[model samples]
Target: MSTVTTPKATTRKPPTRFEIRADIPAPGTPEGAYFHYTPAEAAEWLPFSVYKLLKMANARQIPYVDNGKRITFSGMNIRAISEQFTVEPFTKPARAAA
Candidate 1:
């Protein structure tokens, strides 16, 4: 007599995803989950003028959201964009005596 073999079940892996997160609160909105800034406001956080910010926004150099009349910069928070430009200071290593 031959014994019947049972089939093994296959397990599926979940899809991988990435996301940005911030702890700041959004302004004006009741949700207060995100911190958004206007072009004029985002300029203060960045190292450029509002005119340049607007220009960059128009050129798509920067990311922003437009709601018919106004354009706002908001990722996870206001600092989200500002933090992108953050640079660490580098120090020269000490040289050995000759």
Candidate 2:
């Protein structure tokens, strides 16, 4: 089985505590980053195998929410996870024949 390498641990600052009406969003700022997505939903872009995602979730490799029946990932986290695994194309010129 392939192993997943999670991002390096970092000191995450505690989330700022505040009281705001969730029904109303701040101006110019969208409040749609908190949506959760199923592994199948993320597969559209992540293109990762659903089985792998579930295995990772089961092994606590990736962020997930298993509500005793279904497993889902927050949209923000899913996107971030996908970005972290993206491999940029090689841009440097090939080496000359030695």
Checking candidate 1 for backbone clashes, the offending pairs are 26-34
Candidate 1 lDDT over 1-98, as tens digits, reads 99998998988742111112334344435554255556665555568777777777778776677666466666444455556667879999999899
Overlapping backbone residue pairs in candidate 2 total 0
Q: In candidate 1, which residue ranges exceed 4 Å CA deviation?
A: 1-35, 75-77, 91-98
Query: What is the model-wide C-alpha lDDT for candidate 2?
Result: 0.60
The TM-score values for the models, in the order shown, are 0.46, 0.50
Show model 2 residue runs off by greater than 4 Å: 1-32, 88-98
What is the per-residue lDDT of model 2 for residues 17-82, given as tens digits with 9 covering 90 to 100? 121223432222345356555666555446577778777878887776666556766666576667
Error of 2 at 60 (Å): 1.5
For each candidate in turn, give its C-alpha RMSD to the true structure in angstroms: 17.0, 19.1
**Global lDDT scores for all candidate models:** 0.59, 0.60
